[model samples]
Target: MQFKKYRPYERVENIQRDWPNNHITQAPIYCSVDLRDGNQALVNPLGIEQKLEYFNTLVKMGFKQIEVSYPSASETDFGFTRMLIEDNLVPDDVAIQILIPAKKEWIKRSVEAMQGVKNGIFHLYNPTNEFQRRVVFNKSDEEIMNMAVESMQYLVELTQEFQGNVTYQYSPESFSQTQLDFALTICNKVIDVVNPTTDKKMIINLPNTLEACTANVYADRIEWMSKRLNKREAVILSVHPHNDRGTSVASAELAVLAGAQKVEGTLFGNGERAGNLDVVNFAFNIYSQGVDPKLDLSMIDEVKAMYEKQTQLQVHPRHPFVGDMIFTAFSGGHQDAIKKGLDYYRKEHCQEWNVPYLPIDPKDIKRGYEKVIRVNSQSGKGGVAFIISEFLGEELSKEEAIAFGHMVKQKSDEVQRELSKEEIIALYQNSNRV
Candidate 1:
């Protein structure tokens, strides 16, 4: 497989690292790029009607910022932007972000698309990584820097013509791969030109674009940039991590601890390639840790249904948080422990959740306890006893439970599959031991 052909990513050195000791005490500002990043990656992108439906879902789910589309990219994108504005579909508190390239024509069209919106973020991006600059654009360092600076200047001028409140967002498209010093240089240059104040802050988004390194490296880069950027308080440090390395969630978490205040991701990590960071997974992780994610995810099933319908993409059954099996337990020992924990929890009337095997209460996200345990060949007496007690409203003696457990195990082995609760109940009803 030529495994040795690939070289490891360079590690950050000589930096006083602090993110390892830091904890994310609060949720970051979440911006769903589902309509743009997620939609574009689909085999069939959503039409305007479907886009509106998804946008409404995101708004209801409590997102303050949503990247609707790249207006200048296509007619559909442009029309969606105007639809949200002219139709007054955007809520007063929500900001609709439109992506634009550093090109002048695209920026002009994007500005036109945002004409009457109350709150908008005009996002401008240019590739700055050495590979992209040399291979893709064949431009020198000065050329790339000038492109970003000039684009910001032009965007500032065009935004002044609009009547709506417009915020500026700049992404060094492949910031994770770009030289840290050069990345800082370009971002500071844009900030200098934009002259953002505390009242109106600009966003500097450091995107992992390809998720090239380990999560710790991403955190190191974020902390390094956060500490060094000029007018740091006047700029919101943001991260847009991709999942090429399957660590976007970890990278995003560490980045937040490192000082990023905004996160740009899709609902369930839908995007190009492996996909963008899964915002739902990231938020639920925080929620499990006792921090309020500030989003109502209690209707996760409904959200997943709409997302799959619109994008024509399926959420993996094993996907974290919203996955079907996330809260399900099949291991006999695990099921037994969970049963004991629930019993203890109810008897103590505990204010804090400390249930075994469950990080956060399943009911908190509108999931039921019906599937928490499933009988299999490895089934034990306690799990079988609990199932009988809960489903049949009958208590089994210790000896009876042990006898039934052996029978259930035999049945499961014969079928070579996990037994449903109904199947187990039927077996119990027909058993001579019963």
Candidate 2:
């Protein structure tokens, strides 16, 4: 007798209702810190022209705000921020922001760099958790919080004193690990100290510097905090998550759903350690769901390329969407279903619209038809036939399909990688051309 598979205990109706959605339609803002946070984490950051090119690329992709660099960190960072001024490449619509730790000296230099650019914001952050306070500074909680409060007040006063169109944002670094009530208390005190204007919203970016917990647990805390927040003069809750646990993007999505509005991340999740949350994945997630994510993400492949060239860091083929196999299916069953699905879908939807099975046809991205199908031990007959049709302009018979499939399996044992369309054609010609 055969045993039946175990059924899930969760309510199917609720699962359908509350299940995770790709945040495609959500109107959340995209803020890429590629030049600053992502670059700092890299083994080799971008040069002046590379930085300029990357910054311009981000702006073209519809990012209105970018964390360029903190001038105080190094002469290199300082000069790059200055190049934006000398070249006048800073867009009127886009605002450049800088990252300065919650220290007086760094704040001083960061403020100094803002002298030339008229439209710029300053994001001041400090380590507030017990671990950082204890390990890094060997200071008490009272001392650290007091320093943070004073730091925000100092930053606010500094910006006002300088007479500029600046906005203030502060993050409780490594915030996800902090206690619920303690984090709330610090956030409140920081906001009160900053006292931002209504027209210019104050952002309190709470970073999961390292993703240390589940998304829902973090969501619950954020929801609880948003309702409790007092100084509501246009406060934007922000999230910056690192991928230590490989759940940064999930946590960011849940946190946004929980209450956070603005998101801070790298474009392709390039950063120190395990890396930062991928805003492309996070942004497209919202886009594919039919919501306006407020980003022109069509040039994502270019962004990934620039990043790889600049940082000398390669993107994994398994990287979502822009990766190698995102739109390609190799499994026999998957290929069969996808082939039939496309045929049926094309009849109904406009030719401009992509089928539901694939987020995008690889050809749309200029990847060409040659690499679309790779026949291997795992790939099915439908996949082989689809590849054959792409190259030859006609369909293959079931018998012809099987004949080709056996050749693929035999060839698979010979070469390590899956056979390309060209190789398959060469094999077919070698045997049948005779």
Candidate 3:
């Protein structure tokens, strides 16, 4: 009965859905929403100092656009926005963005916060979902449309007096749940009001505020709108995917294939409920495909450490690319294949990365190969031998390795746990009576 109460996601009817055949060969224009989206979800949100530190890290990572805060919502957010400007902490190349509701009082206050900003974005959002329209606001279609139009009109008027280069961005909150036609209409209408040119483009961010469908279906919706939206050439089409369905990464990848030019997400997928899209995970996905993601991820461990320190959130040990156990192999068959693959790679001097069980080299992200093999009762002889040879750097014949492997497995079994590298080495010395 609980399952029956939920309605199925309506499939987008498109015979020419090209995203399935398309591949993402390049990185999207990434906008990190870590401070706004990621920070809001944290149990202990970062203070100004922490936020500034995080912002600097994003800049160092080569993020061009970062949504810093919802300025009008709180005193702290407003102060942070001013500090970045008055303190001159923002770089000329980076554009610091602040979110604001489509309301005049908030917009006016947001404009005040953004004063003296060199390059900035005034992000406006309003819920456009059916439930919000019919029940929450109790407003008709025309009324809702007018609110967005008038807000854009007022926002433009307020920002015109400012000296900085300003870019406008709009998000139809809960965009994935809105009717495809209405979503397109609302976005196009906002574009018409802004009248963005090729030199100065407006961002239309379609957020999966509440993910309701499979990744492919979301791609179809994006493609459908991308094909039909007006002033398309002057608009930077973006997608902000939330990880409600545990498919935010897949959804973002498909959205890019479907014609999205920009992606708004947080590092490590930190956000409300499940989380936002993990930018590092998505970026490295491109890196794994032999494309440069443009972000400096070579020091991922350092970044992870900083993120954990600021947010007090521990990254899952099995998280892709930066995880502790991602490159590890405890299985005998896997260990054997990986060892063989690495050996072949070094022997053949291959240009392409084609190692078995490892996608990109761990060294590419500054991770060492020492932890790739660990010994336990479940591990095979090949794994134990691989660890001995790789970690201990002991030269052993196949026969000697097998003999040593048998000893390691028995010790691990006797201990009823994984054998540490030190313990394994000790076992090896005892086996040889060395």
Off by over 4 Å in 2: 1-24, 161-164, 350-357, 363-369, 411-417, 426-434
Q: In candidate 2, what are the lDDT values of residues 1-434, reduced to their tens digit? A: 44456332211121222224423236676688888989888777677788888898899889988999978988878888988866788888888989888889888888888876767878887887777788988998888788888888878877785454677888888787676567788888888887766787788888888676777666666666776675755788888888888888888888887778888889789888988989988877766666676887767788778878878888888887788667777777777676666656665775554554576566545665455556787877777777767677667788888777777777876886788778877886687721
* Backbone clash pairs in model 3 (N, Cα, C under 3 Å; residues 3+ apart or in different chains), count: 0
lDDT of 1 by residue, 1-434 (tens): 99898888877778889889998889999999999998889889889999999999999999999999998988999999999999999999999998999999999999999998899998999999999999999999999999999999999998886777889999999988899999999999999999999999999999999998999999999999999998998999999999999999999999998999999999999999999999999999999898999788898899999998888888898788788888778777887798889878888999999988887888988887886777899879878888898899888887999899989999899999998999989999999645
Which candidate do you rate higher for lDDT, 1 or 3? 1
What is candidate 1's CA lDDT for residue 306? 95
Using lDDT as the measure, what is the rank order of every candidate, best first?
Answer: 1, 3, 2
On residues 1-434, what C-alpha lDDT tens digit does candidate 3 reach at each position?
Answer: 58998989999874488888998888999999999999999898889999999999999999999999999887888899999999999999999999999888999999999999999998998899888999999999888888888899899988887788999999888898899888888888898999999999999999999988999999999999888877889889999999999999999999999999999999899999999999999999999998889899997888999999999999999999988899998887888788888878988999999989998899988887888888787777677666667877766677776777777788888879998878887777776532
Root-mean-square deviation (CA) per prediction: 1.2, 6.1, 1.3
Best by lDDT: 1
Candidate 1 wrong stretches, greater than 4 Å: none
Global CA lDDT computed for model 2: 0.77
Q: lDDT per model, in order?
A: 0.92, 0.77, 0.89
Q: Looking at model 3, which ten-residue stretch has the lowest summed lDDT?
A: 425-434
Worst-scoring 10-residue span by lDDT in model 2? 8-17
